[model samples]
Target: MQLTDDRLIRADTDTVWRAILDPEVLKACIPGCENLTGSPEAGYEAVVAQKIGPVSARFAGVVSLSDLRPGEGLTLSGEGKGGAAGFAKGSAQVSFAAEGDATRLTYTVDANVGGKIAQLGSRLIDSFAKKLADQFFERFQAAVEGPGEAAEEELAEVDGDATAEKKGWFKRLVGG
Candidate 1:
């Protein structure tokens, strides 16, 4: 599947660049991302749990950045195996630009799947992929700017240090 989209982030281009490079921000923004480790230079290892249709699986993958252009753009690519659920690999070419006082972030994605996931049909997979991409961008915007009403309610319902950790992560990025 191929998808292209963009959103205006309530942050400067530099700030958006920094947030894209931050592992914490990436971890928080990715839907169902249970754990993400490593740095931008060395690539990242991620574990994500997701339920698509009736298939639920835990995916382990490595994501890396390439084609660096400083504040302009870069490409993100990753592949994961979900045991019986099959495997997926994709790449996104992301671009960032300064628009007014905010940043306009755009991405074009190309993805492929095999194994049991391929049997799920292109319609289901395409819709799911679009939804996932939409969720990622929305959550990334919230992470860089501030939590929306739904995020606030979700944060309120979640107990303990998760919320605190998320807040601190954002603060650490913004504070410096």
Candidate 2:
């Protein structure tokens, strides 16, 4: 599968670049990521768990960044063997540019899978891949922008503070 998308991060180019290269930041951004260790120059090792359709796997892989251009961008490549579940490998070309006080990040990804997972057909696999990509990017954006940005935006669109709209835990549980 192939996918391309872009997001406007409400942070400076340099800050965004730093977050992209940070192992802790990357680990927090990737969904189901249990562990991520290593440096950009030497490549990183990762353990991620996920369930796609019916197949569940804990993938151990090596992720690497190449063609880096400081605060600009780089290519991210990785491959994971999921034992009998199958294997997945992919590469993403990522670019960054400053737009005013923010950074615009664009990524183009090409991914492939083989073995038992391939039997699931293209439609299911494609949708799962798209969801996974969206999840990673969304989480990354949130990490860079800091927590509560989305909640603040939502509150701004409403008439009152979001706290006033909240219900107690018991009320929500009983559909009160």
Candidate 3:
């Protein structure tokens, strides 16, 4: 599946970039994510748990960042397996720009899945993906801007892919 989105962040691009690259910030924003270890140059390992449809499982995976342009953007890719549930792998290109005093973050994700997850229809998967993205971005924005600063107004242009892929993996682990 493919997904894209952009959101206006209240912080400056530099601040947003630094926050986005912070493992602690990411772990907090990702739903069901238990831990995230490593660095931008070395790569990261993650563990997450959730129930997708009727299946529940924990996924352990590795993510790498490449083609980095510093505070501008980079490519993020990773894959994970969930025993009998299934497996998922995908990548995303994320970029940032100055939007007045705020930052405009945009992302595009291209991903594929196999195992029982492939059996689920695209519509179901798409809706689930959207929900996951919305939740993650909402939380992420709040974290970056500070709690209570994440009013509905700032979420106006939000969009993109990584969170949905995480959601897909959760679904994949459960079954299609």
TM-scores of the candidates in the order shown? 0.85, 0.85, 0.79
Q: Which parts of model 2 are misplaced by more than 4 Å?
A: 147-150, 153-176
The per-prediction CA RMSD against the true structure, in angstroms, equals 4.9, 8.1, 11.1
Summarize candidate 3's per-residue lDDT along 1-176 as a digit string, tens digits.
78899888777777777776777776877778888999988989988775667667687888788898888988878777877878767777889999888889888877665677656767766666566666777777767764342323243325332232122221232231
Task: Find the candidate with the highest TM-score and give its number.
Answer: 1
lDDT of 1 by residue, 86-174 (tens): 99888889999999988899999888888898899999999988888888888888777776656665776785434543333454567
User: Residues 1-176, candidate 2, lDDT per residue (tens digit)?
Assistant: 99999999877788778878878777887778899999999999999898878999988999999999999999988889888999988888999999998899999988898888889999998888888888888887777764455676575568466544432222233343
Worst 10 residues of 3 by lDDT: 162-171
What is the Cα root-mean-square deviation between model 2 and the actual structure?
A: 8.1
For residue 141, give model 1's deviation from the true position in Å. 0.6
Rank candidates, TM-score, best first: 1, 2, 3
Residue 59 lDDT, candidate 1, scale 0-100: 94
